[model samples]
Target: MSDSREVVRGLLRPQFREATPYGAPQLDVAVALNTNENPFELPLEVAEAVAGALREQVPHLNRYPDREFTGLRKALAAYLQAQTGLSLPIESLWAANGSNEVLQHIMMAFGGPGRSALGFVPSYSMHELISVATGTQWIAGRRDEHFDLTAADARAQVQEHDPDIVFLCTPNNPSGTALGVDVIEAVLAASRGIVVVDEAYVEFVRPGTPSALALLGGQPRLIVSRTMSKAFAFAGARLGYLAADPAVIDGLRIVRLPYHLSSLTQAAARAALEHSDALLANVEELKSQRDRIVEGIASLGLTPVPSDANFVLFGGLSDAPATWQALLEHGVLVRDVGIPGHLRVTAGTEAETTAFLNALAAVQR
Candidate 1:
């Protein structure tokens, strides 16, 4: 109709004019392992419970959902307490459609023109995307050659940038390495503003790794963001939440839209949380498969980084893009994260893992 798309582009913000949306390729492949999603499907009993809960709320669709989502918060608090042995109050919990939205709410409340946020390079892409969208300056800090941050290095970077918000991604994505608590504490001490510890993959962490939730008390500016999408196999449910001080949670409330959570979402999440044990029964199995992938790739002579998360990032490819395409030709899909020789693959069931390994070995030869 008259170059409406061009007209829209001409009126867009300068910073966004050249920006492309963030997403991995969504292709129909025999084995999909790109997005780091939990490979297991929800247990049938849990799914049935979610369906029943949704049906119970269907009649009340005409009414607005509980704006505070009080019940969901209580469930989350209880879940955290049981998981971490931390006595979390309901007021310390907040949730959104997904952790991305939860992050947006934090940015809206604390970030804006003239303020800056800093994050280590090659972490979650969305952290920078959201910062730019909210008009906050995004500062890219460097990580070491191995993608690991030491306490001294982290503190130095934070002190140098003096950003208003600092992001720490544990079990960091695209690399699958978890940060130690000392590194986190060092950054917190160095920065004078908010410190967001993104723990979306925390549930898959190796044994003996501690969660940031244990550091919540007395650190008013610390926020730990988590998601059901990864470990709980609730990616389809779109439920992400954060644990922080009550004051921090209160700030998010000011930025969130009214009744941001729908009745159906609340019901489904609550039902899943009720059967947390059954829902998480496959975690060990996934961990085993993850180990298998590491071993299989290594046996082929590829360099797979030691991973604490459900995905593995490997290097040693002569050309990552070419290998990615070759793997796809074999009906297997993995993530080419723009790193020169690295690609990321999510751990799937034993059969899926076998298919991926076979495809990779064939492609390598």
Candidate 2:
């Protein structure tokens, strides 16, 4: 009789409540490189455009937003074409609240109960959570120290699980190493189902390195998801899109809720697209800063992985949990990667980078 409902819930995924590293901060600090966020504030022009769009619209919170978000989709498609140099039809584009929701749509559309999803270990954590939430099994293949996607290893796992969907997070979340385009093509060629390339950090990479988006035509089963969150300085806006064949987009539409995006969100995203050139310029700056951080970590006798994204993963101290706590005590919050002694730190503003670097030095000493 006492809380029988709560008692009925026998347990939860151990990882769900496993005291993971997130949101640990107290006093206001001048620098915060824990979360991978664009250090630059939104450009004045971009902010004004977003505000102007909202002002032009009649207050219509009473009415739902455009269910399909067609206009915004077209804007995004055009922006992507400019970025990736691929002609993308609006029908080939799908938008969601963020890459997270975009990812969920992919899982819902292709993976379900009894299906399986493939991912690489030490990659994004969301892939596992999304798979579990959708009642699909998540299978991970371990990567070597370099974080390269070994074709042989991937092929063996693909053959074993025959997953309904595969996720490739380029410039991978923790390691920040991007899988080569050729490696990605090989995966799609070998994959028996959909292959999703999450290019959430593409902006930070060098231009010559190809994006998975460039391989869309060569591989019909490929789906490339990008987010405005990191590079655009719009983590708060939460706008993300997936580029795929029209059929793939249509499949996701079947599973998405009506009016998945609010008009304000759509307006903001569209406006943000107008200033992508400026936003990407900041990305170049971040890349330089990231290089500095990586080199600094290595010079300190730590092993820093080669990174092409907004963050870097490094190993120095033997105990990650203790080191993470130590860094926090010094007012530096960082991502505590579950790897034995690894940590991920975002490339923040110059000031933030200095704080992280100084804190790391003090902690290691």
**Number of the predicted model whose lDDT against the real structure is largest:** 1
How would you encode candidate 1's per-residue C-alpha lDDT over 1-365 as one tens digit per residue?
A: 55997899889999997889999999988899999888788888998999999999999999999999999999998898888889999999999999999999999999989999999988889999999999999999989878898999999999998999999999998788999999999999999999999999988899999899989889999999999999899998999999999999889989999899999999999999999999888888889999999999999999998889999999999999999999999999999999899999999999999999999999999
Best by TM-score: 1
Candidate 2 contains a number of clashing pairs equal to 0
Off by over 4 Å in 1: none
- Per residue, candidate 2 scores C-alpha lDDT tens digits across 114-157 of 89998988898888888887888888877886777776777767
Give lDDT per model, in order: 0.94, 0.83
Worst 10 residues of 1 by lDDT: 1-10
- Mind sharing the TM-score for model 2? 0.93
Please count the clashing residue pairs in each candidate, in the order shown.
0, 0
How much does each candidate deviate from the true structure in C-alpha RMSD? 0.9, 2.6
